[model samples]
Target: MDPDGDPARRVRGHGLGLVVAPVLRDYVVVDIETVPLVGTGPEQDIREIGACRVEVAPDGRHLVAERPFHRLVRSEMVSSVWGSGLSSPSAAAVDVADPDAGLITCQAALEGLAEFCAGRPVVAHNGRLHDFVVLDAACRRHGVPALHDDRLDSLDLAHIAAPRIGIELRPNADGSMPPASRSLDDLAAWFDVADPRRERHRAVPDAELTVLLIERMLKTIAGSEPVRQLQRQILQTGRNPWARFLEPPPADGSLLDCLEADTARMADSSGLSSDPTSRIGRRAVHEAGIHARAAVRLDEASVLAPLSPGGALVTGEGRAFRAQQREMAAAVLVALADGSQRESRSSTSSAGRLAVEAPTGTGKTLAYLVPAVACAQARRRPVVVATHSKVLQDQLLTDIETYRKSIGDIRCVLLKGIANYVSVGYLDAAIEAGPEGPIEALALAIMAGWATQTATGDWDDLSISQIEAAFPPVRELRTRLSVDELREFATDQADRLCFYRCALDGISTADIVVANHAVLVTLDRVVEEASHVIIDEGHNLEDGATSALTETAGSVALTALLDCVAHAVSGAGVLRRYAAACGASPPHERVDEAHDALVQCRRALTELGSHVVDYVRGRTEVTVAEAASFGVSYRLRPGLDTGRAEFARARRAARALADHLRRLSGCLALEPPMSALGTRHWRHIESELGGAAFWSAAERAGRGVAPRPRRCLQAAVCVPRASVVEPSEAGVGRYRDIGRGCR
Candidate 1:
């Protein structure tokens, strides 16, 4: 056993006493150690080196018994340790006789390890730290990159294996938070694996012992079917490994308050109160929720089983949408079922893709949900319903809750980004900092309080316009909030704004996901990566995509900017009115330039509108492209030639605005990061929304197609044959239950 050998020899002896258990079928356990030389600094030679390798088989696990590689070199120069005290200690107490010798020996040991563990994934306890350092140092010494290959960490494995087992290597015996280093034997004993008991702390035997411990733990945590079920749930939610991780909170946190506050501030700042009846903001939010719910139901309906020849006999008064919803739901059901069958036949199936053009008020949410649930029940796949607006997401949740009561054992989860959930730690930080910290934090606190008061994060729960009265001014004072605070806020907000498509893409583990059209557009961009997509609100798809693809610098917007500039430059009271109307700061340079442009544009528009009215009154048919060109030339071009004087000034202002716009567009555009989350390419949509001529031009540009005449067409031609509006127009009763006298 070489009793009176060198310290490296002693460590090798100690390592040999350790036994390693195997985790994988063909597992190779490895350990590496490096020592820095004195005076040599970071660019020094290794003072000592040691390593070990072992393997396991079904018959029995055995350590490959070639003499464990050991080397030692005397340092030519004195050097301090590279890692912190948290790192492992060296093999010996005294300096080596020669550092070069140690490097040579270490090189030999590493060479042996490479040969031993060839064609195997390296297993190490905290492999990134210990093995990485040793290998990197060795590679540097050898004039070649250290071994580069797939490696697994036993520490991570341990966390996966025995989650409750809390083992800390540092602090030594006192457990008073001291040196943060690990010993191989200590870990083996702690984890109840074979102890090599080698007096010397070399690599090979230590690696063997680690392998043994990991193997035992793997067996201990092996599948029991029950464990697998638990694992699936954990995997699905991607939550904490401990206890029922899939469960959500009773309510969404603080979002309603923040939203309410934001909306009120927006209204106040923009002078929305003057009209009082202009419920655009309120209605936008509410209708978003209502439509989202309808969309989901519509999606559900598109998958349901079709009605018989007799159809569903009309019973109740409010059941107007039932028959149509059932028909739509049946269509979706056929899609899902056929899609599933097709997938069984091939690897991909488009059967689950259903595009329904149901109108807004037709109870589409139930329609979608019914068939979605049916498909889910049949195939055990989730029903994911997504909408474009947050308000609609809230409405879907309400519908889910309502449905849950009516239908038993229906599980639904409304997922937002991680930011939506309020963090206790952040709240504590804010509360500890007192009221002087960030206004955002303070606003967040108020929002948190409101969350507690309300049952859901629905803004409608709060009285309209009370948010500003309740929380008033958001603190403008500068505060150095910690990254933790910022992160908490960011994460919470992300949750609120997270696109449903992203959630679906991320966690395919769910049974149902609800989202909007933007998300569907995003899905289409990455359609190959997703499974079984159905887009509700089929009528809105083109328009929504068009809106996404287009941009408008309208007269109203240009006027607003000019108003701000006028306020800034001329100190006019009208400027203040502009600010009040637009909810923005007075513009300085860019605003002035924009104002000038807007003036020219308004004059041009006056002329163009007159021309258009004249043309419309004079003729029965008009081409959109011709009109758009006329409008653009007359309205937008004059401002262009009045250029170059303010061009530099505009450019200077524009550069900053452009940067801001780029960032905002990047954030909002359905492209890249945003597109993956449900933002469709807005540029394409924008091109379409530039009126009839633009759309005509775009189509012609793409396929050499000509534009259709833009005449005052009947709404009946545009409406689909399946549309209820179409049937009702023919003197058919449009009541909820259209049972008899229809045909």
Candidate 2:
């Protein structure tokens, strides 16, 4: 009832009256508001604790009582770090005391919240890391007892629940906008569960809204069989959720192993030697596979049966199949068979290419997956299913899991790039180095908690983006703490321990392999062997491929590279420092030349960035005209022309940058950061263009390449389609005539 009793909560033209609702079960939801305070140092202080305890009637259709608890804690300190993004709470909503109504201290607020919760399991959106961490830290500072032990993270729970309840949180079709996935506000809007307060960045409103949203989700999946398992998963999460990640995965035997044996048996029956090592046997198997796939009738495939309304999918999964899904599935089936018929081999992206314009709810995943798996089984080889994101990759694996029994159990495995796995060596080094700041400290703690519990040790499995959303700096920790030496992947005996090799080893036996587009484009052995491929998010294919193939350097990144070179030349780098300590000086004139190039590189980068910005403005204006609240995306279209003079100036600066690279290449390998840019920037600088690309690059560079500033953005060097050629040895087949192949 006391919606605005706390003057500390800035309304900011947002609030609404309460709308009471029922819950699926009796539960309590709590939200806490915190602001940085200059206590012993820059630490957070809880200014408010708002909680809602909901009880449903025996019928489970109505509410008993929806009790709300709110408290405003006194803020005695006026000093704190303003730079922290969290200080908006401090600046806008300071709880100052008045003679009429003085605010209570944080200790008093906690005690009151404990009494209000009264042994009910407390829930919060991102409570495990965000809310509970703040509370535990504050309790330690105040010497107060911990109030709650059993907690559920609505953030993690919502993700687990979304698919179980058939909610689609994937990106839009073109994928220009990322999903507004996990925020309490976004979730409320999606679930049609609104906070009447319409308020946020507050305690109780968020807590109340969290309860309504979760109740709605739980109710939607209540009749399903996974609800109990979902409930169990929801309970086990928060801080260290025990996932036996490193434990031996159960044998996911191939779904088509019997079929393979059957093919071998067929070869033997035909009086051909069944050994794969024999030429006759190899020919027999290949011909048999081709005939088997050719014989597959698209409309009657067993894989598609599981995706039908009157089929096992509906009978078992509680989800009805749509007609659009069947159409797409048949189309993919036709495309895969067509690719098998083609004389010229094509890249997985281009092979049997048919763009099905599937909107969000088209159930396109199952459409492609079932067909892809069927094709793989028919061919007796793996079918690679590629997605642009970990979200879809995870969803693909889940879909396979959901329909595995109905479709006849299939062996599938997820494979990510080596850099995605954590390096135990790097992690130990990071732990020994300790945290430089509070965010780093928190990030390390979260990583440590996840490291021991995670089986995959892959960044995506950890859902790193969630942690990074809370702390932006956490993104850097992926590589900073990921596998330090990728060469360790060469052999099992390699020193540094990482999980990527283990993941890769599973691919050989897998019937269907799920992977992100980045890994697929990188030309893994899986792509070479995969007889059929399904790119689910093909709209993002061009961009992902371009990003995988290009390297960009910005002024900030260029400056970092320069600093590395300078350190090496100035006897300050690791190698030079050792020489300096041994009383050996570096080459004097060569050192001076290196330093001068470093300075010139900085100047040229600044100049290039300025002129380049002016050049890119009016070339058909391909970027979105509407301003994004999130941020603007600037796409640099290829073949745009600037004035010859302007082009020369920019080109001169670029030439200077290229020259600087040549000089720095000799500077003790530019330490590591210069080489350590990222997988995208894997040093195409000195790489060979193999005669064909050199001329193509020269032609494209003449058209004036545009580089965006301070971003790892690529300069589009698109050439005439006819001029480009793929190496014959390249495992991927060339789409000589994509216009013929593409729909």
Candidate 3:
């Protein structure tokens, strides 16, 4: 007989189409138990076999018709403690007066069962584990493959049957029916059906109960749409319902059409306009195999698109090409060379600020790169390029390396955070010396692992766990070796960098410093002096700056500080003894200072947060004497009074910190300067505690406290050149600038 032409095979073929129809076919619920199962070896013998077959009605009435097949065999050893609860009870429980006669009866029953389920697919409750035990053991001993390969597991079916409930065959911790893993008898009661087994645990009755439970489950599931989808996944791919059904593309479909279709779908899903002229829109139309599209609203989208394509060279000569290179190196070069696109850089004084509104697929990276380098060469100042993503960071790194090789002797450096870079020297030495104890040993191992990947010298390679492993007993160890201890154990050995040293070199004086937005914002805030800065991925500027300035008073952060204090006090035991040896007071002043700051900081945060909430939602509108409502001070600007209130609390906290530092300067003294306190801490103190002088500098950078009269933040962009306007909007990039702030 042809297997494909068989009735059972024909019924399965119906699944290929997306329609559901009932078919006449029997399914068997088969289960098996193993012999010598107490041992841990892979192979085991089949001690018992059980099966019950059922037929599905066309009207969806699944009925159990056939008597079940049951078999049991004598084994050399039966573990009563473990095997007593299993399907085939212990040999002691068996009513076998004659073991030899029982073996013959069991073998005959197994043969009959196999013959009965000849062409039908068998269903089992976790059939994979049970069926494989029987199939593998029997096939090995009998020298023949056992039964069919297309068996279905009821455990999987039960999961599909109950879409909301997850599948598990184990009883719950409470010893109750765990929703989905209920026994066959309990399951039958769930559907309010009469069980023929009468609570019997024998093989034949259990199999019959399984059939009845499945019939009820199928009936319950057939009514739900979600269950139908689950059934589709089970029947089609034997995968979860979460898997998408990817339909094939239409015949004779062009790549352009696919792009258009996809773009349309994306536009719909994102709630953006599918039309090209919409405020937020994407147009993907292909011309001669080249997809010409724009994703408006995202500043980087226009520039990033073209760079993604192979063999696509971006020059500012063409419309489609010029649109993509905004802010990237290539676009920057063209803007400097071409007068028409040069006006976009009006906001920055050193060179015109290139605000490339390029869509996705536009070569924005190249646009900024070429023009920024040109501006840097023209001005003789180091151009600082900043991006948001680490991927873009690596790309810019490669770009700079390529430029150094091709575009003359220009120096560049990729500056990541110190914590991100691993210290290979420290890690290697620590591992070589080994650790003094468990914590130290764990830390050493972490450093060893970090050293292996310290190729880039970046600490971000390992997760928070790796960081903890590198510095074991992180909360306990302190004194002069605290920093050293963590550093010694850090898996971040491979990615270390001398940031301050690298910044001060003559030959190595970086012409371009590639960093992230957060790093750049920090540099801007800390460094009083300004340099030529080209903000790449500028769309993220507002959000990044806000995050840097924002403070959150969360319990976790509060708890961490408390833990730090606890660790410091605990670790001070050794420090106190050392101070005693030198005839000095304990360093309790640091704890006192931190405690005072915490109390004031907490109070300030609570008061300031309420004020900010009011400012964000409050309306300042009022009716004028002329019986007409006049709008005044509608919104808060950078220098607005309301905005100032939002930051008033943080400012007070900052001032308190500065005052605490003054007190520290007068009282706190170190014995030979704790080696744990690095230059970074001192620098932070010097900058943060320097008072009103820093606030004046910050005010100049549009970062001062918001003032009363100017209640809204307004920015004006002035470009000196008429030709700098993008071709899409001719004359829009001219010498004049316009902007207004509204509430």
Candidate 4:
């Protein structure tokens, strides 16, 4: 029987209508093979076109109907485009049809392909980068109208559906190099989708494989309730749920109104709660009461006694507590609760600070937490638990939950910087602007569901890097909202409002506030409010402090600043617009002077940064060694001095640039003509000047050869010493010398 005549091989036709539907309809999966041209022109040719129409059941199972549409188009451009007569291995891989066998012209093939697609949404693997570009170029070259249907990329879908199977590198036959693992064949194998064609790299087999991959991907997404609800909302509204946030708010009311209405409609139809607080509010309140009662019961003896070894207070669940842990907890509790302990000999009362040193697996987290929570409860002040790493923060959170059950319900909140939370207003603005690509649309969809379900709007909870990677514009959209704007937007939704209140405004009110050291150190108010603070992984404190305090005028940063100034001088950046709005055009001569100064500063900084890198590399030889207990150690070569002249020159150039910035800002801040916005810009420029000064000061302090006002720690060195060791039954081993002779 002829393959085209067989019922199983026949293509099923579906009509395309722009109507809202709860289920997807009239979808096509397409793939094309093409010969790439060396130069830009209509000099490339499409070798073949293959497509499969997909049908979805009401229950979410999808079927791929193999009505294969295959076409071979003749083109004279191939020989000229390939220059070397198509002798490349990749070119030789393609199976081209015979020119004498009545193959259709390029125009005819595209027209036939368009007819087959019927204006339906098309799906293709890596379509954004490869397939779509080829098809559009081929259409343009042949004078055929371009396919205008909505396009989706299976490559992006694969990332969302099977995130664990990231692109891997596989060695070639000669083991010379490894290629990126994004091929259709590799992806098919990864997803366990079957490709029946005997030869790979052909259009038809790849198209078929893509359809099977889509089937598996959709099945996985459909299995997830959050994703499925979002999918349905997108289909039913005929507007991408995530993209809708980018839309402009209604003129009469706030953006929050629009978000609430959309969320309420979705919740009503899908039976999901728009309010996350309803799920956890009552328990949170009850827990607060439990913590309050528990706090009142804690005195010095009660707090310290339970932690002591073999004490009567160690009965029940506390029996397994270690002696070291009990001692650490007692020290922390005494420092936190006793005001007398805070009194120093200098006649001034300073807050008592305690540092506990314990090795790994010694229950440091619980030891600190038990005392911190009890002290916070007794003192009626928040206890800040700051960690050095996210791993420790997550582990502490897990332990906190365990403690909540074992101890009492203690109210806690995880607070991060403003950048970590998504702003609904900014998202609305982006939605109004409209997403530019399929990946962006997908990211918006995922975020839409998260916006409703997430109580904190924290990016960490969702843990979807693919979404963020695909749509980086989300980061640009994370603008800082003013207090009034935040309150107005959060007024209608209790749970949404709670996030801002607990995480930002009322942070001091929470029984326990968990954060990273970066947040506590940067935000002084947080540190000031905490009656008790526990710095977990305190061994990393010095390094963390250095990183936070140090400022360097690097080449990349200088280049970016120079570019911004260039744009402003050319009347293209925010500064130019602000000046124009203020009805005072900056003097052209002043702008030119500022621009010239910045260019010189950038050159000096670049030279200085490169010299610093080379100097450090030449002086320091870092060697990794295994420690006796666990982890690794870094040994740095010592007694190397930095060039004083080089440091002085860089510092002088930085100071000159900062002075220029200050002068320019003063010109812009002229009182009579400058508006509030213009003044804000002036202030911003002043802030930049301040930053430059700070960087210069840090550089001087770090590398200064002469006596200075402040003394800075320049380097950390690990010294090794020779020791005589007696061989035991186990073996001979090296030991650290702790005596005066080693020093």
Candidates in order, TM-scores: namely 0.31, 0.46, 0.33, 0.48
Worst 10 residues of 4 by lDDT: 708-717
Q: Rank the models by TM-score, top first.
A: 4, 2, 3, 1
**TM-score, model 3 to reference:** 0.33
lDDT of 2 by residue, 660-702 (tens): 5555433323222332223111121111111112223222221
Higher-TM-score candidate of 2 and 3: 2
Question: Candidate 1 versus the native: TM-score?
Answer: 0.31
Query: Can you write out model 3's per-residue Cα lDDT over 1-743, one digit (the tens) per residue?
Result: 22223432221211133322223356777766565544644355555667877776546555776566667755534344444644345554663555554653334545666787877777776555555555556565645546676565554434434312113221111122224334455455545675564646555666766776776665544442321422332332222211111111112111122223443444355543222111100121111113222212212223334433331343233534443343344445433332442433322222444455667866555556654555544444446777775567767765554444434444345555333443333333223222333344333333332222222334332322322433435322211111111122323212122212222221123346666676676544212222356667788887766654432222223223323222333432222322322334344445355445444544443333333333332333232321123222222344454236655643454344334323433222333235323333232222222211232222322221111100110010111111111111111111111121110
Cα lDDT tens digits for candidate 4, 581-602: 3445443344455556555555
Better of 1 and 2 by lDDT: 2
Please provide, for model 1 over 609-685, each residue's C-alpha lDDT reduced to its tens digit, 9 standing for 90 to 100: 33323323223233444544432111112234224353333234323333332332222111112321221212212
Every candidate's lDDT: 0.36, 0.49, 0.39, 0.48
- Give the runs in model 3 whose Cα sits over 4 Å from its true position: 1-331, 336-351, 370-381, 389-395, 398-411, 416-437, 444-458, 461-497, 503-508, 524-532, 550-554, 568-743
Candidate 4 runs further than 4 Å off: 1-52, 55-63, 66-151, 154-255, 258-295, 299-354, 405-408, 417-451, 459-464, 467-501, 550-553, 558-743
Q: Which stretches of candidate 2 lie over 4 Å from their true place?
A: 1-303, 316-318, 327-362, 374-380, 405-408, 417-419, 423-425, 428-442, 463-474, 481-489, 492-497, 537-543, 556-604, 610-643, 646-656, 670-743
